[model samples]
Target chain A: MNASDVVTVASSVLLVLGSLLTLIAAIGVTRFPDLLARMHAATKPQVLGLVLMMTGLALSLGDSQLGWKLTLVVLFQLITAPVSAHMVGRAGYRTGKVRSDLLVVDELTEDLRAAREETDREQAGR
Target chain B: MRVSGSRKWLEKIPMVLWLTVLWVLFWGDLSLANVLAGALIGLFVMTVMPMPRIGFEGRVSFIGTAILLGKFAVDVLLASVQVARQALRFGHDPHGAVIRVPLRSHSDLYLTLTAVLCSLVPGSIIVEAHRLSGTLYVHVLDVPAAGGIAKAKADVLAQERRVLYALATDADIAEAGLPPRPWKRGRTDGPDPTTAVGPSGPAGDDQAVTR
Candidate 1:
């Protein structure tokens, strides 16, 4: 297939796959109980879906400039995604909203408990 | 150069070149002025881009954000009519239950957007979103007899995440995937996760959820 045709076909396939993954992820976000669990479902498919769709579009349109813009679009995506997820995770934890059973280890809870105890002792001394 | 991510300036190289090439393509000439202007604009954007860094990563993509807005508009329009009808028929019910549907998204930005989108849907006016807690306390205008409390909350949570996904940076989602998947999407976590403190931390107040 020509590059355009190839990109068109691949993009179509990628978009289909990406859309499916995204739908599943979104479903999990809603259906899955708890904030952490929902977040787990929310982030996975979004990046993949964007990458697939961008690659597809870059291929479909051979406009060198637009393609590069799309590449920039992709680059920005990589940088921002993880940062956002981390924030949500921390917020969930701080709020005690995380699914405790699923968590293998939590350094945060220990730190909080220790800090609270220290405060209690200080208050008692005062 | 201790930060591994900072060194990946090359990762964005393709995008920059792509932009330069785009500038050339758009101008359709190798004029000195065009080249200089394009280079200047490109470099300026690149320098400014990294200045704002949330501890988590971000992957900016306009295509996706646009896609999401399209979906939100449709949902809002449909929901608005439904909510209007309920209000007209039943009058206002102040007794509507307040729910705290927590989401897994970690950022103040995403949570805020999700809250705003939920409130915009007509039936739900988000009363408060404990940013520190990630819990959205939304007042559902009409509580369904069949669904009860859990169902009402579920409906709102599901819709909220759809909006969140629509707005979140694609990079945020992908990096979150680097870790292995947690098993089973079953069972809601309980209210053991309550008790609010300050809405945001000292440094992060600017980005915390507003709605």
Candidate 2:
């Protein structure tokens, strides 16, 4: 086989694997019990899938300019995915979307309680 | 005061150069004309919308950054499979928990980087971050599988330590109460197994039985 044929085969494999990962991530989002859990599904495999697919595309194209663009796509996703996930998780926690009964241990609730009590005590002293 | 003013401008150069490179990349052609246009646009955007200055007091370590990125790629791969398994295991339910981890570093840059890294890693997400206390509240998809609360907390601390080595000054490392990074020694000891166990049970407890 020629060099181009090998590149084509490798790219095809990567593309298939990446798509499978994305499908699993979607399944995870649907099956997961809570908002926070769902966000994990949305961010993790989804980001990795994008990276893999981008790599495949870059290889198949074999153009430096297109490769740079593909690199940008992965870089932007890596930077933004976590920020979006954090925002969603934080919002879910504040809006009572998180199921406390499902959790084994919750230190955030305990710390929030302590903080509130401290504030209340300070106000009472004043 | 004048020296500090120039230093602030110097700090902005990297931001501008990054923007310029992004602009050129988006344009798809690397030429003198494209670079000049990108630089011009980058300058325009910077002046039009100034961002809050994020002080970076530490120098970058090439070895530390390589280690950080290399380990991160591995973590993402392993965790993605783990989460995928949890999803596919039809009869099983993943026990989730929100555990607070107090980080040693107080710098905004380190804290933000740590939080971002933690969230992107598959099984964990940052539900809340208490800036004053330098604590991150992370929600883990499967606590027992992740080795437990103590293990999860240690992972986060380990991440923060890597971040410090990648960017924080030696003085900052000392301030955070961590020993000097052994860059030349490489591949330090693994997490202490005794401390890795959860409070309620031994770390080896089965997934269903633990919770």
Candidate 3:
């Protein structure tokens, strides 16, 4: 009814939504078939869910200092999430954990093959 | 040449301001004393650390930037809903695929930005990036057909065009083989679609779909 009450309701809605999204992300991690798909589940929803939760907390607190702190959390998450995913994906690929069949297109393998051929030709020339 | 030196220092102001704000937030206070201390710490950090020089070779178009941001926000919402649907599906195997996208821009900044943006969206994540060829290997959910692969590549190119419009130099634009203006829809002048390849079928060793 009041302004403060409206803020409270909105914040509460955001918190619930954030929590649900995170729960879905967890379910996705367990349910997804391969490492690549699992990485998708682990990063996407988790980062967005955290952002939503942070935003909700910022709104509820109503303090500018706390708001900026929450913003910092979101910023760092955004920066780090993709980098970490890239690392894990690369590791999985190198370790042969990724299903080659699941890959609809694989340019990396072709590139590697080409490089290997070039080196083989150079060795033969010697 | 005289103003260039001062301009470089001026450019660092935004980074310093951001650092100061971060410091204030870390301390959990907005008092005058905290603000002063934060400023001092920010100055110290800036002096101690040699920050990477950001390429701001092009003019900033505020309207273009706003449009890109708006598009990104909509994409995030839509992609999240789509992923959530797939996530909650009961007793259904996920048909995900990794697709390779050949980008037009060779710039490291562009490649990095594109990867981050794609990963931020729910359905796609960049697994490997080839810097030499400016290609990205993206793992995507539900690529049922060849057309689906095309659609994914198109989405990434569209995002790149938006980014170029917002903050790309003329040289960057030329490198990407785009016109000075925003890329027109259905423009066949861009990179050839044939370069973008998806597997016709399972390559080798088709294992059971593990869930």
Candidate 4:
């Protein structure tokens, strides 16, 4: 097969893989037994899947400029995805939405409780 | 000096550099036009997305997270069939159990994701969560057996493993000192209509599994 044909085949493979991975995450978002588990499935799949799929498309684009733009969009996503996840997670935890019984041990419990107690003590002392 | 929260973005310089490199690779050319454009876009985004002041954990690995996604998919497909069948068969007061699951997650993000995934499945729902105990209370729509006391517990543990199995660092899950889905044979003093001695005694494991 010619170089372009080979590239096309490779890109197709990547696209399929990426699509499948993304579907799993989406299903995970749907089927995971709870919120904590679902989060793992959702964010990671989305960001990585998009990057892979975008990579394939970029290769197929046949233009350095358009490829760069697509790459830029992917780059922007990689940066922002975690930040957005962080924000949502914090809100979920603070709001008491994440289930914790599945956890075997909680490393953050002591520090978080201590800080909360300290804040309450300060308020009471005031 | 009180750390100016504004300067926190400086800490992200490394991430920005990494992102810029990705842009270049994806674009496949280091030509001036692409270079300038990528730089401009990265800088503009960085300037706009204000980082939160947080007692943050360590970095997130895209590769590790991707692996977690694969595991979640397998679990979901399996769970869907389980839930759908339960919904269709033996309709009355389908026994359900709500059990608390806890995990030693590095960040709240991980914890929330776990909860969201579980709730999406047809049978399970997360009703309450406490970050203090890191406890999540979930109500399953179907019980494992008429006397589903065993299934109740198993459901909780099974879901727990599926979720934590994906994201928990090996050390974290192990250190978390979690449990396997041991049948609550003895501790099951609770009402289990699915019990072998119960009216549904002739039921197979599949029927015996649901509440």
Best by DockQ: 2
lDDT of 2 by residue, B89-153 (tens): 88787899999998999888899999999888899999999898898999999998899889999
Model 1 agreement with the true structure over A1-126: per-residue lDDT tens digits = 676677678878877866765676566555544564444345544555576777777666657667667776765765565456556655666676654444333334554678799999999999
Write one digit per residue (lDDT tens) for candidate 2, span A36-55. Answer: 77787788899889988999
True contacts kept of each: 0.00, 0.75, 0.57, 0.07
TM-score of predicted model 1?
0.41
Sort by TM-score, best first: 2, 3, 4, 1
lDDT of 4 by residue, A1-126 (tens): 899999999889879977976776676567655455455456655655676788888787777777777877776775565555545655665686755554333323444678789999999999
Please state the interface RMSD for every predicted structure, separated by commas. 15.1, 1.1, 1.8, 10.0
Q: In terms of DockQ, which candidate is stronger, 3 or 4?
A: 3
Candidate 1 reaches a DockQ of: 0.03
Q: Score each candidate by Cα lDDT.
A: 0.54, 0.83, 0.76, 0.55
**Which docking band does candidate 4 fall into?**
incorrect
The lDDT of model 2 is: 0.83
Model 1, span B1-211: residue lDDT tens: 1445644553455456666765765666667888778877776777777433333233322344555677665655455444433333423331234455777666776676676556444445454456787776654444562146678677666654454444443335544332211121131243212211112322123332222
Q: Highest lDDT among the candidates is held by which one?
A: 2
Candidate 2 wrongly placed segments (more than 4 Å): A124-126, B1-5, B184-211
**Candidate 2 collision pairs:** none
The runs of at least 3 residues in candidate 4 whose Cα sits more than 4 Å from the true structure, single-residue gaps closed, are: A118-126, B1-211
Superposed model 3: Cα runs more than 4 Å off: B1-11, B25-36, B145-147, B182-211
Displacement of the residue A3 alpha carbon in candidate 2, Å: 1.5
lDDT of 3 by residue, B1-211 (tens): 1335655566567678888788787877878988888888887888799587644445444555787889987888777877777889978767777777889887777788888888888788888888888888887776752148789889888888888777665556877898764433354465423322112222111211111
User: Tens digits of per-residue lDDT for model 4 on B1-211?
Assistant: 3554544545556557765776677777787876777777777777787455333222232344455567555655556445434333432333444454555554464556666655544345555556666666555544553235455445555555555544343345556565421232354466444323322232222222111
